[model samples]
Target: MIWEVFRQEKEGEYHTHCGNVHAPDREMAKQFAAIQHGRRKPTNNMWVVPKEEVGEVDGEKYSFGGTTDKSYRWATGYNVTADDASEVVESSDEQEDAERRRSEVV
Candidate 1:
């Protein structure tokens, strides 16, 4: 059986897929993952999951971002006042331009 390994470098960081280990059971897989993946890096935590247990969702199967106007999440969507800093206004303008170009491409 094959087991997937994910390693987290720090306490608050995300665990990323590192490598795979060939083991007969979960406990042996964990041990093999520690010896193979953990020893090379500053691993704060590690997870060993069976390859058959992992699930995946692809873009062809589902749309990632919903078909809704979510402009409120962008800087350009906010109302700017005169009291706002010039840098803030500049950033909003740049974001607006970028958003426009991105929309055109999409």
Candidate 2:
């Protein structure tokens, strides 16, 4: 099974996908993932998804970077001359409904 580790960054914030873990079942995998990824800090919640249950499709090329030479791929790429935050412009309105996030570290 495929499982994902979601970490709560702060109070009143939804858990974010820190990483994924794979195992036979959701419960066991979550147990493992929690210790490996979340036990170091105070995690509000954890979700373990069977690898088979987690569905993701990588685009033919790169769905995230519409074109080549992506400025979006760099660490400080967003510290650009543009007035708009690249993430805000690219993210759909639906994503905004999920939760707002801020962190000193991921």
Candidate 3:
């Protein structure tokens, strides 16, 4: 059986697929994944999932976020006064930048 290994380099970060390991069971898969990929990198966490359990969806099968414009979801769509909090302002700025980038992409 084959097991896919996902490694997370830091805390609260995303786990990316590093590689796969062939093992008879889940326990052996974890051991193999740790030795093969986790030893060299700064691994915060690891996930060993069976290949058959994973599911995927392609662009042809479904449309993500739909075809219509969803400007209401953006922070800029709402009218609001400037806040005194730095975090709020930073988040708004990030949202604005994301909206701008998305517009450019489309």
* Candidate that scores best on lDDT: 1
Whose TM-score is higher: candidate 1's or candidate 3's? 1
lDDT of 3 by residue, 1-106 (tens): 9999999999999999999999999999999999999999899999999999988999888878878978899988777765646688899899999999999999
lDDT winner between candidates 1 and 3: 1
Quote the lDDT for 14 in model 3: 99
Q: Please name the candidate that would achieve the greatest TM-score relative to the true structure.
A: 1
Across residues 20-90, which tens digit of lDDT does each residue of candidate 1 receive? 99999999999999999999999999999999999999999888988899999998998987777788888
* Order by TM-score, highest first: 1, 3, 2
Ranking according to lDDT, highest score first: 1, 3, 2
Looking at model 1, residue 68 earns an lDDT score of: 96
* Alpha-carbon lDDT, every model: 0.95, 0.70, 0.94
Worst 10 residues of 3 by lDDT: 77-86
| TM-score-superior candidate, 2 or 3 | 3
Estimate TM-scores for all models.
0.61, 0.45, 0.60
- State the lDDT of candidate 2 residue by residue for 47-82, as single tens digits: 665555667777865567546767777867666554
Residue pairs clashing, model 1? none
